[model samples]
Structure formats: C-alpha cells, structure tokens
Target chain A: LAKTTQPISMDSYEGQEVNITCSHNNIATNDYITWYQQFPSQGPRFIIQGYKTKVTNEVASLFIPADRKSSTLSLPRVSLSDTAVYYCLVDYNQGGKLIFGQGTELSVKP
Target chain B: EPEVTQTPSHQVTQMGQEVILRCVPISNHLYFYWYRQILGQKVEFLVSFYNNEISEKSEIFDDQFSVERPDGSNFTLKIRSTKLEDSAMYFCASSDEGSRNDEQFFGPGTRLTVL
Candidate 1:
C-alpha cells in the first residue's frame, strides 16, 4: 500500500469540468491507482482505475504519466449531484484492504 | 447489476451488547470485506474473507470481532461486545475475481449507533 496525497477540497460550478489530482510518490511497480466517489451517507463508489497511461469510463477518466507517481481524475460536465468526496487509493490487491485517506471534498455549486 | 445487500440499514445497540451485521454479497462474487467509517472520518478496513475463512484483518479487528459465512448466500460480522466507539457506518463489499484490477462492489452500509 502506498500513502496518497490529495487536496483537501475543491470548488466548481455546474457544467464545469473538475479535475482532482492525487500524489503517490512511493507507488510500487505493481501498484494500481484507483479513484472512488463517496456521497454523503453512502459507501464509496468506484469511479475509475488505471495502472499507466490513460483510462476512460462512463463516469470519469484517469490519467497517469510515465512516472506513475501521480494521477488525475477528470469529471466532465459536472452537475450539483457530482458534489462528493473523491478518494485516491494505491494498492496492489495482495492484502485486499482499502486504505482511505481524508480524500478531496469536491463541491459542485449550481 | 447485482449489488451487495445488507440488513438493518440502521441499528441501535447498548454498550457491551452483542450485535451481528448481516450481508449478502453478489451471487457470483467470491471475496468479501467489511469496512467502517466514523462520523467525519475516513473509511477504514476491518477484515477480508475468502474461501470460507479470513484472509486478512486490520488491527481494529480484535478478539471481540469476528466474521462468518454461515451459508452460501449470507456473510456476517459479529461484535461480541460493542463500545461507544463502535458507533459508525459499516459497509460490506465483494469482488468477483480478487485480482489486482478487480472491482469491488459496495453495499449501502449499516449505521450502528452504540450508546
């Protein structure tokens, strides 16, 4: 498991694109970067995951550079419902435990 | 989309009382996990189960805490003696392949209020 660092909070307006970045400087070769979104009083929902390069899904997109030390989660055309906490986790699936940090609180205003 | 399900969306228990949180993972999933989130705190892993046994547990899972797969369809987490600090939201999740890139689907969670 690698410790991750992310902004404590971010503010955006509806229809704006939001990008949250996470830094995992000690990421291992086998580590995978995964992003999750958590609404209030709900469990975290998986958004996107990637080992390297870029990966896109219906909800979000993940971008990883060649170094793999950091990654960004991009949510296009955000809405008020998109306001939630975004967490970045680094794990290799060996222990199968998810270690969550404080995460970045994304506030989308209408 | 088959999703994990948990019973008793909310539970109120007195300190020192025993409580069991029940969960039904996805029908075809193999790996199960339990996690907790205190008010305004990060989600913390409690334990992971596979092959009818516990594969890993965090320091928070002590002798008072236990997990069981009583049958094919149900998984459970039992706390022999609850404490005030045990008040939190517990989430159940399951992964199908349990590989490096496997996705774990999470349930709505049970909010346990220990008083």
Candidate 2:
C-alpha cells in the first residue's frame, strides 16, 4: 500500500469549490487513486476515483497528474451538507482491504 | 439503491464476553469486509471475505476474531472475548466485485461498547 498525506482540515463556504490534495510519492503502477467521504457517525462513502488525468462524477472530480505522485479531490459549489471527512486511498486494482489514514476534514459553512 | 445493513445499532457487553455482529449486504454484492474505528481515530480494516472464505485480514484480526456467512445474505463477525480496547464502531461493507473500481457500500455501523 502506498502511504498518503493530506491536510488535517479545510474550511470552505457554501457555493465555493473545495479542493483537497493528497500526496503519495511512492505510488505503484498498479495503484489506483480513490476518494471517500465520511460524515459524522456514518460509514465512508465513495466519491470519485482516478488513475491519471481527470475523472468527473455527479458528486465530485478527481485530478491526477501524470506523475501519479499526488491527486486532488474537487467538490464544486459546496453545501453545508458536504461537511465531512474526505479520505484518499491508493491501492491495487485487486481490491482486498482499505487502509485508511487520518483523512482531511472538510468544513462547509453556510 | 441497494445498501448494506447491520443489526443492533449499538451493543454493550462486559469484558471477556463474546459478541456477534450481523450484517446483510447488498443482494448482488459478492465481497464482504469488516472495519472498525475507535473514537477520534482512523478507520481500520479487520478482514475481507469472498466465496465463503477469507481473502485477507489485518494484524488487528487476531485469533479472537472470526467471520462467517452462515447463509446466503448474512455475514457475521464474532469476537470470542471482549476487551476494553475492542470498543469501537464496527462497520460492514460489501461490493459487487473485489476490484479497485468496484464501489463498496457500507452499513450504518454497530457501536460496540465494552464495560
């Protein structure tokens, strides 16, 4: 598993775009970049994932540079409901277990 | 719209007692997993199950921990003896395939308190 580093917390107001970056310098070729959002007392929910370049979804977007050393999760026009902890995970394609790190806690204020 | 469901929103047990946590995964999911999070801590993976057998497990899943799929829809985790350190929120998740892109739906989690 590739170790990931992210900000401990971030503050964003409603209608603003929030971008949380994760650094994984030792990412392997087979590793995939995945993001999960977790609300208080709730299980982590899948957000967006990408290997390289950009991937967009209904909820968020993921941007991974060619280097694959880092990735960013972008939430557009955030709302207070989006306040949660976001986790960035780098793992092999063969899913086994999720090794979680201290994720980035996003605070969306109205 | 399918989601994982876990029973007994919260459980309180005494030290050295055994406890079983039950989960009903999404009807079509084939892979199951168990994870725990202590208060103010990161979520930790305990084990993963597939095809009626364990695929992998973390060091945290010691001899005291076991997983079983007694029937078709239910997956269970058993702790032979409870310890104070075992107090945490246990989450059950399932995915259609054990692949990186396959999304895993997680349950509401069962809060286990060891007294």
Candidate 3:
C-alpha cells in the first residue's frame, strides 16, 4: 500500500465540474489507484479505478499521468447530493489491508 | 448487481459482553473484508478473509476480535469482550477475482454501540 495525499476539503456549485487530485509519489508498479465516495451514515462506494492513463465511467473519470505518481478524479456537473467524503487509495491487491486516510470532504453548494 | 449484506443493522452490548456481527459477501466474490470507523475517525481495516481463512489482519484485530466463515454464505466477526472503544460502525466488503484492480463492494454497515 502507498500513502496518498489529498486536500482536506473542497467546495463546488451545482452544475459545475469538480476535480480532486491525489498524490502518491511512492506508488508501486503493481499498485492500482482507486477512488471511493462515502456519504453520511453510509459505507463507501467505489467511484473509479485506474492503473495508468485515463478511464471513464458513467459516474466519473480517472486520469493518471505516464509517471503514475498521481491521479485525479473528475466529477462533471456536480449536484448538492454529491456532497460527501472522497477517498483515494493505492492498493497492491495481494490481500493487503485496505486502510483509508482522512478523505477529502466535498461540499456542493446550491 | 449483487451487494454485501450485514445482519442486526445495529447492536448494543455492555462492556465485557460478547457480541457477534454477521455479513454475507457477494456470491461470486473471492475476498471478504471487515472495516470499522469510529465516530469522527477514518475507516480502519480489521481483517480480510479468503478461502474460508484469514489472509491478513490489522493490529487492531487483537486477541479479542475473531472472524469466521461458518457457512458458505455467512461471514462473522465476534468480539470476545466488548469495550467502550468497540463502539463503531463495522462494514463488510467483498471483491471478485481477488486483485487490486478488482472493485470491492461494501455493505451498508452495522452500527455497534458498546456501553
């Protein structure tokens, strides 16, 4: 597992795009970057994951540089319901502990 | 899409009492995990189980905490003696194919209150 660094909080308005970046300079070759979203009183849900380059889903998009030192999650057209904590995790799989750090709390204003 | 499920949604127990938390991972998932979040704290991993045995565990999973896959579908975490510190929201998660690239689905979680 590689430790990740991200902002503590972010603010966005409805219909605006929000991008949260995570820094993991020490990410390993086998490590994969994953993003999860957690709402109040609810368990975390997977948002997007990537090994490198870019991957897009209906919910969000993930972009990783060629160096793989960092990654960003892009949420298009944010809504008030998007207010939640977002976690970025680097995992090697292989059964390592899935520890979560203090996530970035994104608050969407109306 | 299948999702993980936990039993008793909420359980309140007294100090030194034993409590068992149950989970049912997705049918096709090969790896199961347990994580707990103390109020106002980050989520912490407790243990991960695969092939009916524990593959890895965190230091927080001390002698007092135990996990079992007693049946095909039921996975459980037992606290030998509950303490005030045991009060937290425990979540069960599962992943298919058992790899870092695999997506892990989480259950709603069980809020345990230890008095």
| lDDT accuracy of residue B17 in candidate 1 | 100
lDDT by residue (tens digit), candidate 1, A1-110: 44899999999999999999999999988999999899998989998999999999998999999999999999999999999999999965567778889999999998
Which lDDT tens digits does candidate 2 get at residues A1-110?
44999999999999999999999999889888899999999899988878899999999999999999999999999999999999999865446578789999999888
Worst 10 residues of 2 chain B by lDDT: B96-105
Q: Where does the lowest 10-residue lDDT sum fall in candidate 3 chain B?
A: B95-104
State the C-alpha lDDT per candidate. 0.93, 0.93, 0.91
Per-residue alpha-carbon lDDT of candidate 1 for residues B33-115, written as tens digits (9 for 90 to 100):
99999999999999999999999899999999999999999999999999999999999999987676778889999999999
Model 3: CA > 4 A from native: A93-96
Write one digit per residue (lDDT tens) for candidate 3, span A1-110. 44899999999999999999999999888998999999987889999988899999999999999999999999999999999999999956455557688999999999
The number of the candidate with the highest DockQ is 1
Binned by DockQ into CAPRI classes (incorrect, acceptable, medium, high), candidate 3 is: medium
**Lowest lDDT block of 10, candidate 1 chain A:** A91-100
Residue B31 in candidate 2 has what lDDT? Answer: 96
Ten-residue region with minimum lDDT total, candidate 3 chain A: A91-100
Model 1: interface root-mean-square deviation in Å: 1.6
How many collisions per candidate?
Answer: 0, 0, 0
How do all the candidates rank in terms of TM-score, highest first? 1, 2, 3
How well does candidate 2 match the true structure in TM-score terms? Answer: 0.97
Consecutive 10-residue window with the lowest summed lDDT within model 2 chain A = A91-100
